[model samples]
Target: MAIEINRITQVNKAALRLPNQPFKRFGTLLVTRTETGWHHQEQLSDQTFEQTFPEENYQLSAIDAAGFALGAFEGSRCVALATFEYDFHFNRYLYLADLKVDPPFRRQGIAANLLNAAEPLAKAHHKRGLCTIAQGSNLGANRFYLAAGFHIGGLNTNDYRFTSQEGDTDIYYYRDF
Candidate 1:
């Protein structure tokens, strides 16, 4: 059976009710965020960032406050997530962070869909581009970001200080819309 891309509408409307066949055929998925559901948002936050960074830190909180939280759900189950944070230093830009696809849903183009959804949002906010940081040791993430059209901007030594650990290396990547 051919998967019809047109059947997947970006915006949901009551008149265009998705058929159960298509829902079953494509596995009925939707992308949404925490402001839509407080419980979902809390679960998404706990699952997305708890293992990687200081979950209770002020910086992360600021990021969460300013950022747009996104998640892909199959029915009510959250299968993937990505967050975008727009920041201004030398210029205005957006940072893509905490991109994660559930282990069972990997290689299904979900990440691409999430990114596809983000580009316009960034553009609407007048962002010059999108950026991301990948740990040097995480080769899979490094390759994934690169494959998604993000190019290496630079490498920083002792850039990130997490807890008591010091001198962590992080590679930055950016893509102009």
Candidate 2:
């Protein structure tokens, strides 16, 4: 069946609580800066490891108030989701706080489709662009963001400092409209 992309309505907002699908990566993307410009290179780790972000409980009201939320469905089942919110922290950009596709539905362009659906909604809100952050160790996500026309705009080297995730970097990506 074809995956349907639809705006998340209040009645079906619960779809945002998708099942956690952990990921494993064999290496991490290392960021460096030279006189020329920022650089990103992948370094293979000694061992493969799985990482899973803590589960998030998104309030229905908050989801409603967000700039937009979309779900990719195969019939009645929601297999993927994307949510964006207006961020004026630095500029008028929509922050893609959440984007996920279940394991069985991945690699079929569902995630990309959701991103395509989000761009117009963001443009409709008069936002300048869309932005998001991915863990440096998540090679697949970093690659996807780059392939989707986003550039590595910045990095937070201290975002995970003093935590279990210390040594992990937060890579920020932005796609200008």
Candidate 3:
């Protein structure tokens, strides 16, 4: 497939809205704090579900305003998206806030292409690298991030505390330019 990556400007940010898609949760990554530092181990499971987040038009516009967002288009339809911004706290790396590929478009390298397209924009901003957070339970996303050159930089076991997602660790990944 010939996928074209393009910047998602305010006028076209609505293309960021992706339909809710189901996925199989094969396992979870359990992160623990050892005497030396943080570590992660996988716990396998079998489950299927779908989840969705609020992707209001206003929110997309804000993301475009704050930093940069990229969309992968097949013809005129947006099939994949990635949004990132400079990390205020880190002050060096671009924080990847969101990345999603339509279910039918999976395993097609569209996400990878979007990442590749975003790097130059981040570098243009003088960023050292790209950083992102993934739920430890999302084995697929974790593996993709790793394969995309992001390493496990940090983990927070308390990221989802006191919520339905409690016990879910947030794994932070970093890919240096």
Which 10 successive residues of model 2 have the least lDDT summed? 84-93
lDDT-wise, the better of 1 and 2 is 2
Give a tens-digit lDDT track for model 2, residues 10-51. Answer: 767878888668877878888887888779998887998876
Pairs that collide in candidate 1 are none
lDDT of 2 at 67: 67
Each model's total of backbone clashes: 0, 0, 0
Maximum-TM-score candidate: 2
lDDT of 1 at 82: 67
For every candidate in turn, the CA RMSD to the true structure comes to 14.7, 1.4, 2.2
lDDT of 1 by residue, 51-140 (tens): 333332223344456666455667645566666777634556688866766666777888777777777778888887888887654455
TM-score of 3: 0.87
Candidate 2 segments whose C-alpha is farther than 4 A from its true place: none
Q: Could you tell me how far off, in angstroms, the CA of residue 27 lies in candidate 2 after the best superposition?
A: 1.2
TM-score of each: 0.61, 0.93, 0.87
Residue pairs in collision within model 3? none
